[model samples]
Target: MSMATYIGLNFSVKLNEDYTEDEVEIDYVFSSEEDRNVVKQKHFTTPYIYEVFEKDEPIWRMNEDQKIHSPHNYEKSKKTFLYLCHLLKELLPKGDYCEVYICWLGEEVEECEGELKFNLNNLQIEAIDIYEKYFIRIEN
Candidate 1:
């Protein structure tokens, strides 16, 4: 049997004197523990940076197949958001930054927030000031 959940992502950015916020809600469904495990592993092991810093455009794009799928896939959607954070890093002013939050749509899970910014070298996207309580936990 498949389990269903809704994931919510919210982004707030401060660039110089400007502020921007974006929010997305997703319907997530999975058939088994392995499905959740895959996403969890990628979340812990992958670096936040998706591409080189000098690129002017985002490297992530949804393929035809992804666009045709109903109810966005959880893993793909999460990766897309991560890439967006990188894009935010690129657009941030010298001293500006962005904040991201993740939470379950209807569940009692606590929301997790992280600050996204460039590293000292300004070549990599790094997440700092993170609250570790934010993540999906599946229980049997």
Candidate 2:
């Protein structure tokens, strides 16, 4: 099975000196199949995965989250969700809270469900299509 994901960044933008507005990408697309095709067919194009490093070690990364597939493909990493957050702290100032929202399509997210605390209304159940997605909200 081909697992696809939609990685979205949600935050607010300053509209004016007196006003700040929330923004979300309804049209932003991050398809894995499309990315794979690009990698296979396009040699000159830049790779999509980007990361920042400190002292030759990465602070954060968005590439494949350590996948080991079948007999040929094998990959692993020491990174975990908590470790990722710890790394993010080096980039973000103190006292900022980040929230991650994950809700899969084809299932009713039934308002405030999961091991982690998150707003159910923010789930936006009807917006999912074409891929199994994961949304991580990085707030500063």
Candidate 3:
């Protein structure tokens, strides 16, 4: 019989004002099927970064220095936001007129009967709403 497993996905966004160009960073954790059973038990984490631009000019960028934490970690969330603002300094070429937005995605997983079960959640929408209050809109 095959064992069941669960997987989860999470992400966060931030704005920085100290960068010369807009940027984005996405990170995820996934299970590997190519590894042996013992090795497969370990999850793999992947990180990606991209640039955000508007009208051929950088508008704002995400701060890669920020660390991603579990949803229960409120302190890290605050730090993430602060780091994002720092990156925006240089990314927002439009000066104070430009808006910066940050978002995150989260997922949960469980193991059952030699099988893998996964639950996914998108926290980016909530993050967008929070930033929108500050007059920032996450680019679709």
> Best TM-score goes to which candidate?
2
lDDT of 1 by residue, 76-103 (tens): 4435445554454455454433222232
Report lDDT (Cα) of residue 127, candidate 3. 36
On lDDT, the leading prediction is 1
Give candidate 3's TM-score. Answer: 0.25
Give me the displacement of residue 117 in model 2, in angstroms. Answer: 6.7
TM-score for each model: 0.26, 0.27, 0.25
Q: What is the lDDT of residue 75 in candidate 1?
A: 34
For candidate 3, the per-residue lDDT at 46 reads: 14
lDDT of 1 at 74: 30
Report the Cα lDDT for candidate 1: 0.31
Candidate 2: what lDDT? 0.28
Ranking by TM-score: 2, 1, 3
In candidate 1, stretches whose alpha carbon ends up further than 4 angstroms from where it belongs are 1-82, 107-140
Off by over 4 Å in 2: 1-78, 105-110, 115-140
RMSD of each: 14.3, 15.2, 15.9
What digit string (tens of lDDT, one per residue) describes model 2 on residues 1-140? 22222222223222233322312211213334444343223221222221111121221222233222321221111233334444444433444434332222222122323222222224332221111223334433
